[model samples]
Target: METKREKFYMMNSMLCLLKVVEGKRTTVEMRDEKEVTGVIKHVDGYMNISMEDVVFKSLTGKKKFDKFFVNGKTIRYVHIPDEINMKSAMEAKLKEMCTYTASMRVRQEIKDQAWAKLKQKERRAKAEIKKERK
Candidate 1:
């Protein structure tokens, strides 16, 4: 079971990784220390991002491409712009909190119902054993 704090952090990170940085001129540092700078074209739920007019730089040299697709798993760091609007980000976080809370409640209810059914079966079995003894 994930603690509430863990869930909150996960949600916040998702928002930052997906919604907060879309269409922004950003830099992504790969695990191999190569850096790519471009405008974000698209990002999937998995965090795999597509960028346009991308430039890749390393210790040796730099190369520019018309378009590039990066696997999320290989990404080490994503550098977002400093001038992001916090008001909108807070509003989006509130909305996501509501949605996440509702979904978690539904999951808890399902687990509770399953446990109740299992308990009821155990009681019926015990009752049957007592009846047989009588």
Candidate 2:
């Protein structure tokens, strides 16, 4: 029941929203001449954003409202640099690889330690039982 133009617009909006989520920082301007700036932590489907000090929830049927806290109808604009995006992507990949390698090493070490401890305990128990029997 949707037209091609509507689908295109929806896709474009989704892309824009993703870019905003991946953005390093966002600029939130309220109607009360107050501006909030910080890294966007999370965003919901309703256009709500969690910033440093404040949480923004989109208002319905309101272009702009008064009072920074109650003003739900504010503009949330985010600008991300291409270089930052590339850098973040590379950093993420590197961190993932490092985490995987470290996890594998830790798991191996834990298994080895557990096996060694079990063997030592078994030996000690066997020696104690033999001594008791004698």
Candidate 3:
């Protein structure tokens, strides 16, 4: 038997980075040219991240915070260490992306079917009313 190879693309790089760097020191650069270094505390599916023991850094100086939450939309870059192994992270990310895609496809299919059924019912109701009027 022959099998075909499928091409997989990274859907959310931030989610992958969050998975690989959780509990590890990370440096996040914002679009405004500010940087924050901390240990990742949590990450949501939206890529919003929370960090513990954060140090906000800029050309001016550095400020410390016990915890911080950064909006995903504001992130410019997330620096990951070269020492961390990427093979496992890539595998996990692929699985996550596949699951998400599958679910979305299923939902869309259900919605299309439901809409078609609704239209059919409306047509039937109109036919019944026309017959009564005759």
Candidate 4:
């Protein structure tokens, strides 16, 4: 069997940074000059955000909301709490969120088992061909 060497890729990206601030208080400045301060509840791959206890502020006025959603495209800037160190936060969040989930692990195990069984059958077939040749 030939072993494939894979290149190492770090999970370093803006969404990775956003994942660190999940369930934490943060501020998002919108492109339209609105600002939202709240606890970030969720951040998806597209950078779309769901927040709780949101306070939306604009030049016109301020509004409070129990929950809010921010489109990824409309976001201009994000303010993560100063207490959260970027390096440490990214490391911790990546460790927690980047690993395969239990379901994924199970699926991978099934795939490997199937591949092994297939290989074993192929080897047995080759062995039988050799016996016939003898």
Report model 2's TM-score to 2 decimal places: 0.36
Tens digits of per-residue lDDT for model 1, 1-134: 44566456646565334556778899999999899999998765556789999999999999999899989889998886888765676577557767879998999999999999999999999999999999
Q: Worst ten-residue run, lDDT, model 1? A: 10-19
lDDT of each: 0.80, 0.52, 0.78, 0.82
- Best candidate per TM-score, number? 4
Worst 10 residues of 3 by lDDT: 1-10
- Whole-structure CA lDDT of model 2: 0.52
Give residue 111's lDDT in candidate 1 (0 to 100).
100
TM-score of each: 0.56, 0.36, 0.58, 0.70
- Lowest lDDT sum, 10 consecutive residues, model 2, at 61-70
Candidate 3 deviant stretches above 4 angstroms: 1-15, 22-24, 28-35, 41-52, 57-61, 66-84
lDDT of 2 by residue, 1-134 (tens): 33455334433444234334433555666665555555566544334555544334434323332222222355444444444564565455445545765897899999999999999999999999999999
lDDT of 3 by residue, 22-94 (tens): 7888899998899999999776666678999999998899999999999988999888877776777767776
Give the poorly placed runs of model 1, Cα more than 4 Å off.
1-12, 85-134
Off by over 4 Å in 4: 1-12, 101-107, 111-134
16-67 per-residue lDDT for model 4 (tens digits): 7887788899899999999999999987776789999999999999999999
